[model samples]
Target: MWLDPFLSELQAGDGLPVLDLGCGAGNNALYLTERGVPVVACDLSEEALKLVSERVPEVRTLVLNLLEPLPFGDGTAPAIVADLSLHYFHWADTERIVAELRRVLKPGGLLLCRVNSIRDTEYGAGQGTELEPGLYESGGRIKRFFERDQTEALFANWTIEALEENVLLRYEKPKRAWMVAARRDWA
Candidate 1:
């Protein structure tokens, strides 16, 4: 889906390391691996990593909890991508995770993030979807929706390259979500 465009922006011979945070099922990992990109796919679920390994053995996967500090050295990766998984963290934890992500990424490296929009219809502002109270279920996991400006403010230091809000349909119903991209400044 959106992965192709994101991948298209990356140069083939960039030779920079890539980390896929919350790489569930590893579909993107498998696709990127086939393109000769070196990717470190990580998730909190061992079972999910195992499944990804069985399906795409070439992808390097490690068990990781995003709430804690990242396992890589500073400026280790040139590109970091977390698709539809960051919302699981509370606002405080989210700040730490973003800081960790910036710490790991090289200067001018890209961070691609996709999160649910607050204007969602089906699972937008409902009681059943919230993990605690304010959050909602964006997909198979619990998430908190955000306005465009809120998302931009989360990474205020970085330069936002693009931001888009779209409705991902489920069984012919529109589900509000957003895809945003930002670049870490040279430090």
Candidate 2:
């Protein structure tokens, strides 16, 4: 998994449970729990959370909607894993959600995430009606792809520890995405 390099930093949260935002099927949550890290797996789908609960009974599960404000307190979460969940929104909504994520994280906390890249042609990069520069709508679903500069602009307020475009082969076809490791440096 891409999270291997950051395990130590992720575990440095003083035993606070990590929030796995948009945790579909709890893949990352399971990985973290298997390594002895406490995790709270959150998703919008109750079925997904149920599957996660069945697979890892020790993991705490919550139903979350990204469009609304997060239920966490300010500077509470030590680490958050967004995975491939931050791309399904309009530009403004995306910004708002990211700001909320930052607000819920402790100073120096990490926000690890992956998002669809502008070059991800195999996964509907330019397949639908363009809502904005990188935002699109197809089959009633909205997706936002990020260019390098766009991703940088999105996280301009935070200290980006790592940012790279990489192809993931976990799926049947190659999936291109931007892997980001950003830190909330201020409270």
Candidate 3:
């Protein structure tokens, strides 16, 4: 998992419940819970949240749409995990969602996320109609692929702890993505 390297640092802070944004089936949520960390798993699908709740009864699940404002208060979350979730949006929506995430995170809190890389051909990078430079619409859904500069621009307001491109084999084919750990430094 992309969060493994940052687990120690995450556990070192106050025991605030981590917000698992776009938590599909609770993969990252389950990982955090196994290590004794509290998690509030949020997703757009009710069925997905149901699966997560069934798998881990202790996890709190909420149905949330990223395009809308998050329900949490400002600076409430100590950390958040958005695994492969932020890519499915237009540029403006992506920016708005990220800003919302920043607004909810505490100062110095971390946002650990993985987004589709421009080189991710196996999972559709340059396919379908191009909505923007790196954003594409295929199969009635939008997906945004980020170059190094794009990721830098996306988290320009935050303190980027780590950003690296990697290939994940969780799917039938290899999926290329950028793993980012950005810290919210200002309120």
Candidate 4:
């Protein structure tokens, strides 16, 4: 998982923040906090923030909608974890969010994420209405699935340390996802 790479690169008193964008239910937040990494966990749900606080009292939790600009100082984040949270956006919104992420992260900082892949037919890959080239609308929710080329194109200027597609089970259903580890190369 990302914990090995993230924890290995961080210590308890590191000044740089480890951002947990869209930290739903505090799964990753608890993991990082338990391992002694200082984390700032943000989510759109107040209930989720409550859960994080209850689960890990030391975590810095906030209610944040990722579609807007992140509420952090520029070049302050040293590492970010965005598990299954980078989807669900139109092209422009996705670009804006990525731009904010790049702006907040320090040079050589990491953005590790898992995103929906186009191959995920077992979940609604081909069933949804195609909104854009890689975007779809299902059950009133919009999600963007990425191919390898799409992933490469989205973060074209970043140092893509790793990008691989795989099928795994989540919440008892098979999920087609892409694991991405990309770094900001310049300040």
Would you estimate the TM-scores of all the predictions? 0.86, 0.98, 0.97, 0.93
Model 1 poorest 10 in a row by lDDT: 125-134
lDDT by residue (tens digit), candidate 1, 1-187 = 6667767655442776578899998876787888778788899999999999998887788999998889899887878889878877677778788888889888888888788787864655553456643466556756677778778878898888888997766336777777878888998
Leading candidate by lDDT:
2
Superposition error at 138 for model 4 (Å): 1.6
Which has the better TM-score: candidate 3, or candidate 4? Answer: 3
Rank list by lDDT: 2, 3, 4, 1
The RMSD (Cα, Å) of candidate 4 is 1.6
Which stretches of candidate 4 lie above 4 Å from their native place? Answer: none
Cα lDDT of all candidates, in order?
0.79, 0.94, 0.93, 0.84
Q: lDDT by residue for model 2 over 1-187, one digit each (tens)?
A: 8999999887777999999999998899999999889999999999999999999999999999999999999999999999999999988999999999999999899999999999999999988999999998999998888999999999999999999999999889999999999999975
| Prediction 2 global C-alpha lDDT | 0.94
Model 3 bad stretches (over 4 Å): none
What are the per-residue Cα lDDT tens digits for candidate 3 across 76-121? 9989999999999988889999999999999888999999999999
User: Could you give candidate 4's per-residue lDDT for residues 1-187 as a string of tens digits?
Assistant: 4457656775533665699998998888888777777899898989989988999889998888998888888888888889988988998888888888988888888888888899987766766799998899989998888888988988987899889887776557889899888899885
| Winner by TM-score | 2
